[model samples]
Target: MTRRLMLSYVALALLVLLGLEIPLGYLYARGEESRFAQSIERDASMLAEIAEESIEKGNLTALPELAREYAEDNPGARVVIVDRTGRLLTDSAGTIPTGSTLAGEPDIAAALRNRTTVATSTGTNSADVLAATMPGSSGTTIRGALRVTYPMTTVTDRENRIWAVLALAGACIVTAVALVAFALARWITRPLRTLERATAQLAAGRLDNPPDADSGPPELRRLAAAFTHTATRLQHLLQAQHGFASEASHQLKTPLTSLRLRLENFEPYLDPRAHPSLEETIGEVERLSRMVHGLLALARLENTATTPGPVDADAVLVERATMWEPLAAEQHVTIAITGPAAGRVRAIPGALEQIIDNLLANALRVSPPGTTITLARAPGAGLHVIDQGPGMPEADRERAFDRFWRASDSHHDGTGLGLPIVRHLVHASGGQITLHAAPGGGLDAHVQLRPAGRERRFQTIAVTHAAAGHRR
Candidate 1:
C-alpha cells in the first residue's frame, strides 16, 4: 500500500511538471525566434535608410566600407546591397563577383521587384535570413535592396542553457516530493497495520486487553478506540454466556439425580403385577439421562473452541442411527436409513450427533403406528428427517424449534427442549435446522451443514423411522 501511494504521488508530480514545462518551453522558444526576427528586420531597415542617404549625397565610394563595418559589428551577419536591375553591387564577404545578377535568388528577385521579402535556407549555411527592400528614393529612378543573414546557433545555445537550469531545479523538487510522499504514506499506513494486528488477535481469541490508541494519526486513534469498545463488548458477552450455561447445568443436576435414585430404589420392588409400572419408571429415568446428556452437550459445545476439520455427515448419521435403533425398537418403531451413506462436511462432531439424536427422539414420540419416520439425506449436502406422523400445520412449524415449545395437545412425555437443543447444536456447528411440513405427510426437519474440505464433497443423509405406537 505504501508503494502504491508513492507511485501515485510520483505520477501526479510528473503530470504537473509536464503541464507546466511543455507550454513554457514552447513559448520560450517562440519568443526567442520572434525577438531574433525583429532585430534582423530593424537592422535591415536601418541599412536601407543609410544607403538612400548615401546615394542622395552621390557618395558611392563610402558604401562598401560602411557595409563592412556593420558586418564586423554584428559578428555573424552577411550583408549585401543590390541595384533595381538585380545586379549585386556591394557584398560584405567580398568573395562574390560584383557583376553577378541576383535575379536567380528568390528573395533577391522579390526585392528587385520593389517588394519586401524574407526567406530561410539550409544548404551551405543552415540559418534563417531575412531580406527586405524599398525604393532607394521617391523621385529619382534609384532602387536598392538590403539583405541580412543571421545564424540560429546563438539562439539555440541560450535555450539549451535555460533548459539545463530548469532540469536541475526539477530534479531537486522531485527528490524533495518523493521524501515527503514516503513520510506521509508511512504516517497513514502505520496505524492501519496496527489495527490489522489487533483484529487478528481478536479473531484468535487472544484479545485479553485492548489496543493502544495513541500510536498514530487522529483518524487511526479514533479507529483504535472503536476497536477497543467492540472488544470490550465481546468479552462481556462471552462471560455472560459462560455464566448462564454454568447456572443452567447446576440447576438441572438435582432433578436428574433424583430421577436416577428413584429408579434404582424402585427396581427391586418390581413384581409381575407391577412390571408395567417398573418399565415406565425405567423409561422415565432413561429420558432424564437423555435430557442431562443434552444439556451437558450443549454447554460443552458453547464453551469449546470451534473444530477446524471437516466432518463426515453420513458417518455421523449412521452412527447415531445405530445407537438409537434399540430405543426405537423398544418403542415399537422401525428406523430406516436413506440417501448417500458417505458424505463429508464441516462441523463439530459431538454437537452434530446430538442434533441428530434430538430430532429422532421428537419424531419417535409424535409419529402414529405403522407410519414411516423418514431420515432422508439430500445427495449433495445436509440432512433431512421426515416423519409421517400427524404433520405439523404450517403455522406451528415456526414455533416447533423454540425452547420448551410443546404443542398444546401433545401427549408425549418430553421436556420440550428437543428441537431447541437441535437448533443450538446445529448453529454451533455452523449449520442450520428448519422444521417444515413434509410433502406427503408429517413434519420434515432439514439440517444444512457447512461445506467441508476441498477434496471432500458434501452429501445429505436421509433416515426414515416407522411408527409402532399401537403395537402390543
Candidate 2:
C-alpha cells in the first residue's frame, strides 16, 4: 500500500511536469532559431552594402581581402560575391575557382534580380541558414549580389542545452516528490499496522496491547480509538460471562451433592413404595450435578489459552486404555489397544486425556458385552476410539457438536456436552474430530491431530467455537 501510494504521487508529478515543460521547451527552441536567423541576415545586409561601394568604383582588388576578413571573424561561415551576370568574382576560403559561375544557385539568382531572401538549405555534410541581398542600391540597380551562409549547429546547440536543463529540473522534482510521498504513506498507515497486531492478539484470547489512538491522520486516529474501545469492551464482557458460568457451576455443585445425599438418606427411612420415588429424585440430582460440571468445564476451556505441544500418541493410548480396562472387565467387555505407533501429535495440555476419557465413557455406556472397544492410532491418520455399540445416524452425527443435543433413541444418561467439548479441544489444538459409523456396528470417534512439527495456525477453531458458543 505504501509503494502504491508513492507511485501515485510520482506519476501525478510527472504528468504535471510534462504538461508545463513540453510547451516551454518548444517555445524556447523557436526563439533561439528566430534570433540566430535575424543575426545572420543583418550581417549579410551590412556586407552587401560594403561590396556595393567597391563594385561601383570598378575596383575589385580589395574585394577578396574584405571577404576573407569577414569569413575569419564568423566561424563556420561561407561568403560568395558575384557580378550582375551571375559570375562569381571572389569566394571566402577560396574553395571555388576565381571565375566560377554561381548563376544556377537559387539565392544568387534571386539576389541578382534585386530581391532579399533568407532560408535554410540542407547539404550533404551539414545544414545551413542562407541569407541573400542585392548590392549597388536596390530596385534592379544591382552591381553584384552577396550571399552569406552560416551552419545550423549554433542554434541547435542552444536548443539542446535548454532541453537538458529542463529534463534535469523535472527529474529532481520527481525525486523530491517520491521521498515526501514515501514518508506520507508510512505516517498514514502506522495506525493500521498497530490495529492489525492488536486484532491478532485479541483473536488469540485477549487484547494485551491495543492500538495507539494518538498518532496518524484524523480519520485513522478515530479508527484506532474505536477499535481499542471495542476490544476492551468485548474483553470485559467475555471475562464477566466466563466468571458467571464458572462461579454458578461451582456454587451449584455443593448443593446438588448435599441434596443427593439427603435424598439417599431418605430412601432407607421411607416406605417401600416411596423408596422408588426417592431413588428417582437422587438420580435426577446426580444428572443435574454432571450437567453443571460439563458447563464449568466448557467455561474454563473457553477462558484459558494454552500453547500446543508434542505428545506421544501410542503412549497416551496405552495409558488411557489400561485405566479403562477394569470398567470394561466388569461389563464383560474387552478393551483392545491396537494399531502402530503414531509418533508425536500436537495438543494442548490435558486436552488429549479429557478427549479420550469422554470418548471412552460414551463408548462404554452403549458398548455390548463380549464385544471389543478398540483404542487405535495410525501415523498421520491420528487416533480413533471404536466401540461395538449402536452408532448414531448421519443426521445426528452432523449436529452432535451442538450443545445439549442428543439422539432421540439414546437411553444412556448423558449431559450431551461430550462431543461439543471434544470438538473445542481438537480445534484449539489445530486438529479436527468427527463421528463416523464403525465397519460392522457401533461408532468410530476419529480425532485428527496435527503432527508436532507443524505450526499451530487454525482459523477454523475460532469460527467453530463462535458457532458453538452461540448455540450454548
Instruction: Find the candidate with the highest TM-score and give its number.
Output: 2
Best by lDDT: 2
Global lDDT of model 2: 0.78
Predicted candidate 2, C-alpha RMSD: 5.9
List, in order, the clash count of every candidate structure: 12, 0
lDDT of 1 by residue, 176-213 (tens): 88899899888778767777888877775557546668
TM-score of each: 0.62, 0.71
Global lDDT scores for all candidate models: 0.69, 0.78
Q: What is model 1's C-alpha RMSD?
A: 7.4
Alpha-carbon deviation at 143 in model 2, angstroms:
7.8
